[model samples]
Target: RVFEAMLLVGISFSPLAGDLVTLVAPQVAKAASLVFLLGAGALFLWEINAAGRWVWPTTIGLGLDIVVGTMALLATAGMDGGIASLLLINLAAGGVLLSLPKAFFFAGIAVGLQYLEHLLSLAWFGTAERSLSEVSLFAVGYLAVTGLSQLLRQEVSQRQQLVEQRESDVESLSQLNDLIIRRMKSGVLVIDAQGRIQRINEAAWSLLGNPSPTRKDLTEISPELWRRMQQWRSSGRGDYTPTALVERGTEVVPRFVAVPQSPHHSAIVFLEDSSLLTRQAEQLTLSSLGRLSASIAHEVRNPLAAISHAAQLLAESDSVAAADLRLLEIIRGQCLRMNAIVENILQLSRREQSKPELVNLRRWVVEFVDEFRTVQPLGGDELRALAPETAINVVFDADQLQQVVWNLAKNALRYGRLPEAPARISVVARRLPETGQAVLEVLDRGPGIAEKLRPHVFDPFFTTNEFGTGLGLYIARQLCEANQATLELVSVAGGGACFRIAFNAQPETLRGDKLPEP
Candidate 1:
């Protein structure tokens, strides 16, 4: 539009143009041409100041161009002065700003104005018939330009919309990918070609032992792992062997893979904790064992019961020798032990869904200790209950929690008693302020567990004592987990073992009802 305005300004100032205009109307020709030039200049300045707002300027500018061009053509006696084609600018502007139908409408207006100018010139100045042919040709050119410009504008608009839609989709996909990566259990790290960390997820940051903010060098983190990564990259192999990176006694197994079709030559590294992998494997094994135990328990319990019945019948007989009776008693004991093992296995296999309720931890622990002391032949001072100052409520199944506490207390009494100290077991219940979880600790002054054996303490059927069932801690931990709690053997500051059960202190609404104090 600005270029068209500048061209018209030059044409109005030309000496040849002045002579042609003088030959036409002569009275109002120069005045109309000057007004047209000034109008075009004003339109150009309006467009320049319009900035990003093109719709209004384009619409008003097209209207002004058509009106001024018609006036100029009329002043110069129509197409005889050759200014009729200037109206095409209005058609082009309309096509770019408005719709195709509007562009054709403006073209029709321009053609009609030229025809009007032709008729006026013929009436006043009796201009030659050659101007009619020029008017017809200009109308045809106007229609063609309007049609082509509108088609091009429509195509560009469609392409722009498609590009915008694609960009929006890409942004949404990128955000979703980031969310999944952040929440993933396995740690993720994006490394650049220069071996610098471009991005690291929360899990990856934790797996890295949460190194200080200043530490960015992979070599500084783990030189052995960095060397292995470098070797794998340089080897140009399709696959790299997984390696473990140990930091501060925690092992993280890292697997690296190149980013597919990446131009930046980057790679994504996945880090998984070794302990987590072991736990998952153990869970899978337990799942299989649970399925197998159902079948095995039925088969083993029948024979074990028959043996126990036969042993009881034989014991009643007085004809047996003393040595043979002792042997039979041993057999009976073994049979009972085997039957107990089958019963425990069956119990473990038949895991019931947890039905949690809110219980006052302090009162529950005190009552449980009182009941336990009454049932067992222990001194009053041997077992004691220590409650928190304030009432702490936790969500758990009362029966399951009671069984877990009993097992833990029994283990504490058995292995926690030291020769130097008197036999004493303390069941302490308190709420941890930092984590907001209720903690129940069954502690005794026995020799603490060796650090080497702590990891396998919760394993099923693992025992250090010959007469131990070994499933007590395992069953306690399993029950705790089912109730969304944890059972761990934490080493006490003093020389003793502490079996801590941490309960999730969910609100009353989540656990149904809060039980009254016992």
Candidate 2:
């Protein structure tokens, strides 16, 4: 539409004869302006669908305006058609369409064209000798146009920098806000004015049972949450008290707090997993305090002592043959093994200063197993890891590293027994590329840990067995921290448990650097 109008106006104004009869090309110019106004409105509607691609239409419009202005300038060559003002219009149009650099270039072109036309007209029509004031007037106009164009360019450049800085700051702030929410014990959720959930945190996911609600609609995703939002909106309250939500087909209760506040009128919701976290922390603390030997001494110690005394008497008797004496020696050795466990409990209770150093876990575990096998027989039940061919060093205490692996293997062997199936344990080690961390996993097949005990399984003094001291896991956890690593008991499906130890093998600062790309 703008192209058609500009073409018509340029053709209508091509002849200079009309200026002799009239001061202005009033009807034709109005027609051209009307087309621009209407076309601009229509373009806005099309631009919405085009989104970021609207620059093309704007460029075409500005180009048409320039062509029309050029034709008008040539048409009024014999007289001033107030076309200089139209050059300013073209300058503004170009600036709006193409951006600062292109805008400045177009502004310079417009000024040059106007200046050239004025000079050529003065030379052709014998106006050069008319007056010094007229010549100075033309010079001042050219200078003013150039100065204004440069000023606009500088302003545009500064505005661009300011916009870029604002965008960068917003991104940084958004990430910081997300980190704070995730680390916070309280769960927070932000919703837009329409009541749609815009943001959620880790605690919120756990409380909501990792609700996999689609982002399509609020009511469909979580009906209970949808209803609470409606209630908060209707009540027009600043903050809503915590409300219990009974999970579908389950007795689990979730508490939620809703706050309604927004310029667009959005609501924010928060959830607290009060029961789960409390129970988990309590169990962890108790398990950390539990001692294994303290639980088993009354039941196993007396029977073990009787077996040791009998083995000693039988070994001393001359009537017992050498072959029979071998059985007595085995009995005494087994009894001594039980006594050594009590000593292990005492050592665990004593707070020892951690001595940290670079430890090669592969060599340490291998040496411990080799030395252990020289004194005691480990049958087919023993498991061996395929160590990495290359050495991977991690900062840790040598003795503590030995104890952590030993306690974990012994725990797995003791409880991983099977009645009808063969007992098997797996020891595996792998280096993670993302964080440059080393992971060691020990898996066993036995009865899986109960849901009630799972959370507190590592706490001291907490044990399922009557003969457990619970100190083993407690000491293991302490040793892991002393070695700058984390030890966690992860429940395995089907049966048994897996103990995973994660240690830093290399220094890293960026979280993205620690995450492997999919």
Candidate 3:
């Protein structure tokens, strides 16, 4: 469009079409030059055949432009006419649309010729020379225009560079986020202002058991979920909590806070597993109870022993019958059962709340593996650690951290073993570069969680095992969060599970703070 406009201006200014040509002294010369320019354009077009090679056509066009440019110079003995400026327009067009270097060379020629024409007319021709005042004004105007154009060009170049750089950054961040989401056990959803699905990360798609699709309307695509989300939004500010919406395939969508970055314009919604958290809480409660039971059992054992001794003495009496002896034995058996319950309560209550300490993560994980080996009965070969032994460190409650490790290791030992691949557990610690957060992962070669149960796996008292109080994992999770860390389930590539803990690299070591008594 710009090219066409410049061409029209050139034609209008040319003598053949202008009214001033009739009375002007240089009318004949101008008329002849205009004819030559027109013929050059026509011939250039003719040489470049239609529907054929474009290279020869472009070459011919550039050549005709140079020839006409030279003729226009001869026609203008003085630089009185604004013909030179037209050359600048052509140069810019050529540079933008064709090879940049070639276009620059042409522009250089145009500038050089204009300067030569001006110098020659002043030094020799004496044709239509300008007064001193006019000359000063023209020189100032020309320099000012030139400087302004250069400034604009520089600004345009800088803007282009900045835009490119921002695009690259956004792309890199997007890819990294996608990789992380795909490796998560929880589902994530992102909606636009109009409740349209701007993005659904890999986990969300997989959880829905759907193939990846792009640019779909959230409401039209998933009406149920969309309605639930609307309800969540309508619930007002700071009222966000995890809600379970039973969906197709028994899917549970947990409440995740929707951060309002814009004013009711847009936000992100995260769906985590509430049932899992509930299971964890149950485990914590049960474990506490178990510890109490154990303490009670210890306290009762002395009395129970005395009672059993007295019963034995009574049964041994010569007057006592065989039936009486059987009754005494039954009483002793019931006492033994009560003793076992007490022991469980004690185990549940036994939470080691020692002072938190800063420990080098590399050394700690190695020590933990060694400790696991001593307690667990491995048949023959030693298990290996997959990650590096770097000098990573964190300040955490050591006793609580130990319990977390123990539960993860024990779970792996029980469920991860297979004939082909013997049971193995790996404790790894690494830092997240973006957030500079420390993450610990315990990977196990165990049967991956079932899709249906994955969401509820952390609920307290929710056990798949007959003997399980289901409190071990729950307590671990609670302690982790209490210490300003996050315990999460990471989805692995193969049929296995990974439990990851994300904590601040420089965590507050103090455990003096306590929750208000209920």
lDDT of 3 by residue, 1-518 (tens): 22433443354366564543222235434554555556555655665555555444555555455445544544443444444455445454454434544555555555555555455555655653444454445444434444454556567768989999999999999899888876776777777668866667765665555644864676765666667667767875432355434354434554435656766456566666666666678667766765665666678878977887777788778988877778888877766655554543455455445455676666777778888788877775345444445666677777778888888877877766666667767788777779867778888776867778776666544567655656567667767876677788879887688888887536344355442211
CA RMSD of each candidate after superposition: 5.6, 10.3, 13.6
**lDDT scores in order:** 0.77, 0.62, 0.61
How well does candidate 2 match the true structure in TM-score terms? 0.54
Q: Report the lDDT of model 1 for residue 348.
A: 85
| C-alpha RMSD in Å of predicted model 1 compared with the true structure | 5.6
In terms of lDDT, the best-performing candidate is 1
List runs of model 1 lying over 4 Å from the truth.
12-53, 76-86, 99-154, 212-216, 236-249, 259-264, 285-294, 314-336, 352-406, 409-447, 464-467, 479-486, 501-518
- State residue 199's C-alpha deviation in candidate 1, in Å: 3.4
Model 1, TM vs. native = 0.73
lDDT of 2 at 233: 65
lDDT of 1 at 201: 85
- Model 3 scores a TM of 0.41
Could you say which candidate leads in TM-score? 1
